[model samples]
Structures are given as structure tokens and as C-alpha cells.
Target: MSTICLYGSASGGIDRRHVELAATVGRLIGERGHDLVYGGGGTSVMGAAEAAARAAGARTTGVMPRALMEVELPPEGLGELVVTDDMRERKAEMDARADAFIVLPGGLGTLEELFEIWVARTIGLHTKPLAVLDLDGHYAGLRTWLEDLVARGFARPLAFEVVHWGADPATALDHLESAPRERISLPSSEILGSFADFPDDRRERP
Candidate 1:
């Protein structure tokens, strides 16, 4: 009965495997009787996932920024469609609605959403589980970099534990469902300082 938010590419021409994985994740969510929250795009991975979820009887919700309405194409027949003034508002709504998060292969937008949610969880903003499905090793480099941060003493051990990675959708969902419901309340400044040397340009301003 949890509301799971999925973050992924909205582009119409992403890799076929990624799209298929997204659809599979959606079907699984529906089969488990969980609701889905996602970006309200009617193209690419997002569209394929939502379509599958709806077909399987999952309650689907979509949040879209007004500016990207035309570009992303608002999906139809969702249980709910929330249109916000900007990207920040859209993300906020999604975060507030979701009980857990699952990230599929995507680009900058997807990365931004994942990092922000992870940071929020690390700082005790929420006690929800976060998972990344690494379809075709798409997140291999990112995982390595995160591990390096832990090894370098930049990020706390809890930071590494906040994200659960799986090679496929089923495994990721299993990890998420079995995760403990406890929020890590580390000092916000300390958590922020861990990424002090992270590249400024890589940070997205919402």
C-alpha cells in the first residue's frame, strides 16, 4: 500500500533496455498493490512505465512542471495529475506524496532527483527507503564514486547505506520493502560538508 515514486528519463528515444526495465518495474508495483508517483510525461520510459502500471490496476499519479507540459507531454488516464508552477514545486509534491523511491536509468534530471532525495533522507527529512535499479550497469560509475567518498572519509557510513542498488527491478523492490523504518538524523552541516569538494557545475539549481 505504499506510494512509490519512480524517477527516469522523459525523452522519447532512450535505450530500449531502460524502457523495458521501467515497464517491468511498473508492472511489479501494480502487482504488489502499490500506487505509483512519477513525472507526468507521455513519452519514453516514464510513459511506458505508467501505461503498464495502469493496465495492471495500479493507482498512478503524475506531477509535472508547467513549463515542460508541452515538451514532456502530460500523460492521460492517471488517477491524479498534479501540475505545478516550476520544477521545484513538482519535485516537492512528488517527495511529499511518495513513501519510497526507485530510480531507473535517466539523465541529469533523474540524477538531480535521486541526489536531492538521498540528501533529504540522510538529513532526517524522511525515513523512506530509496533504491536505484542499475539496468545494464547504468549507475556503475556513480556507485563507484559514492563508495570512494565513503573510503575517503568524506561521506558517513550511513550515507552509503541510505541507497540500495540492485541489478534488476525485483531485487531493488525487495530491498526497499524490507528496509527498516528509521531516519538517520546526522547534523545537516556535516552531511553538506561531505560533498564540499563535489564539482559546483554538477549541482543543479531548482
Candidate 2:
């Protein structure tokens, strides 16, 4: 019954193995009766995942920045579409809607989403579970780097342990479902400033 947010590549004409992996994840989400929210791109991993999820009877939502409308096309018949004023807003919307997060194989944009959410969780911004789908050793180097950070004392071991890594979709989902939500002792106002103090979503012009 949880709403899972998926982060992955939106580019077209990529490797077929990655595309199948995305589809498999989507199918499992549907079969497990979990809903889905994603970046709302209609190509490659993004599109394949949503399409498979919808086909398997999962309710799917797509969140996108209005600015990217010209650059990315959301799949047709997406259950719902939410347009945000900026990338930050889009991510915020997804964060609020999702109970868990799963990252598929992707490129730079995917990595950006992963680190932002991972850091936010480390700081107690949210306690939801997060995982990365490490298909065919795709994320082996990144995993090594994260471990190195912990070993070097650049990152806390607790923070590093929260990120569950799985080579397959089912194992990833299992970890997410079983992971406990962390309780933060920090005050809400201290962790998150007042809404009034938040900057406007629109970009400033010189």
C-alpha cells in the first residue's frame, strides 16, 4: 500500500539490459500492490518502468518540472501528473508522496537525486527507507567510494549503513519494506526552516 518513488535514467537509446531491469522493478511494485511515483519521463528506463507498472495494475504518478516539458515527454496514460516550478520542487513533491525510494541504473541526473535524498535522510529531514538497484555491478564503484568515505571518517557508519544495496529488484524491495523508520531527536524548526524563509521556486534574473 506504500507509494514508492523511483529514480532512474530518462535518456533514450540506452542499453536494453537496463531497460529490462527497470521494467522488472515496475512489475514487482505492481504485483506487490505498491503504488509508484517517478520523474515522468517517457523514454528509456523511466518510461519502461512506468509502463510495466501500469500494465501490472499499479497506480503510477509522474512528477516533473514545468521547465523540462520541452525536453522530456511523460508517458501517455500516466495515472497522474504533477508539474512543479523547479527541480527542487519536483523532488520535494516526490519526497512527500513516497514512503520509500528505489534508484535504478542511471546517469548524472540519477546520481544527483540519489545523493540529495541520501544526505537529507542522514540529516533527519526524513526517515523513509532508500535503496539503490545495483544491476550487473553497475554501482560497484559508487559503493566502494561510499564505504571509503565511512572508513576515512568522512561519513558516519550509521549513515552509510542506511543505504541498502541490492543486485535485484525483489531483494531491494525486501530491504525497503523491512527497514525501520528512524526517529530524529532534533526539533522540526531547527531541521527545517520556516516556510516563509524558503526561497522562491523561480530563478532570479541578473
Candidate 3:
């Protein structure tokens, strides 16, 4: 069985629909007999998903940063929990463990994780399939911006081709299942040239 890593919010203030969506996705993952890997938190969207997946009989693993333990307490009953010294280590551990990735409604942190994985895929670092569940058009704006970047010559066609999107969990899972297990081969120049240019002073602003 594949181990699906889910990136999503850990905030209790998010919309109820998003919470329900997370739970449903988790349940579906379990029902499909796949394992789950996610941020280890006992509250909000991540917590809800973990809970549902475990209840449905899926093996659940959580990767968390040591520093966030107090704030994002590790949930009870995880089959495995890996705590890292920092966020980077936490992300690395999750990446090494997952066979595929799913993006759910979340905040900036989730977006960061998704982008990092997308870049890794573009560079042929891994062949795992990545998908975004665009529930209620949550990712519509981001998709438009990506396409616009390609149109403006800031990104290559491969950049957009690296990602897949679905309107619901089952569709997302199906896409992942059908994806090839071999890494995509791209010329080194294309990979190196895909990065968008940024002003040197951009980081100077706050």
C-alpha cells in the first residue's frame, strides 16, 4: 500500500467545510488501505484527518518539529511519530517517507510545503505524484497565477505539467494511483532555467 502524505492547516479557525473535507479525505485514504503521513497535531484540520484515518483502520504516521510540540501537541494514538529538531528536518522526514502527496485547504505553511515538493519533482528528485484537492475553488487563484507565470515566460511548461489537481479526494487519489513510478527525465538546462527571476532588493523589504 502507498503512503500518502497530506499537507494542510492546523488552525481551529478555518471554515467548517474545510474541516469536513479533511476528515472525508482521511477516511477515504484509510478505506483504500493506504497509509497516512502528516503533521502531528491534536487540533484543527490535521488532527481531524488523523483521527478519521485511524478510526477507519489506516496506519498513521506523524512528522513534527520539536519546537512546535507545545503549541501543536502530538495527537494521541498515532502508529508512529517522528520528531525533528526543526521544520526543515520535519519536512525532510515526511518527504522521505511518503510515496505520494495531497494538498488540502490550508494556510501559508501548507503552500510552502506544496511548492517545495513541486520544485523537487521538477528537478527529478523524486517521481512521487503530487495533487491538489481544490475544494470549492480554493486553489483557483493559485492555478491562475501559475498559468500566468508560464504565459509571461517566467516558468516553463514543465513547471505547470508537474502538478495535478482534482475537485475532490477520490479524483485526487485516482490521479496519484495512475501516475508513473519512474522519475521524469528533463534536460539540465530546462530544469535550471525554470526558476523565476526576482529583484535582488526583494528580500530587503521586511
Candidate number with greatest TM-score: 3
Per-residue error for 189 in candidate 2, Å, reads: 21
What's the residue-level lDDT of 163 in candidate 1?
86
In model 3, the Cα lDDT at residue 177 comes to 80
Would you list the C-alpha lDDT of every candidate in the order shown? 0.89, 0.89, 0.88
Ranking according to lDDT, highest score first: 2, 1, 3
Clashing pairs in 1: none
**lDDT-better candidate, 1 vs 3:** 1
Global CA lDDT of candidate 2, please? Answer: 0.89
Each candidate's TM vs. the true structure? 0.88, 0.87, 0.90
lDDT of 3 by residue, 1-206 (tens): 88999999998788898888889989988999998999988778898889999998899999999898888888878999999999999999999999999999888999999999998998789999998988899889998998899899877788767678877788888888888767878787665663446465764567
Stretches off by above 4 angstroms in model 3 are 188-206
Give Cα distance to truth, residue 10, candidate 1, Å: 0.3
lDDT of 2 by residue, 55-125 (tens): 99999999999998777798889999999999999999998999999999999989999999998888878
**For each predicted model, how many residue pairs clash, with residues at least 3 apart or on different chains?**
0, 0, 0
Question: lDDT tens digits, residues 163-186, model 1?
Answer: 888877888888778899896766
Worst 10 residues of 1 by lDDT: 197-206
RMSD (Å) of each candidate, 1 decimal: 6.3, 8.2, 5.2
Pairs with steric clashes in candidate 3: none
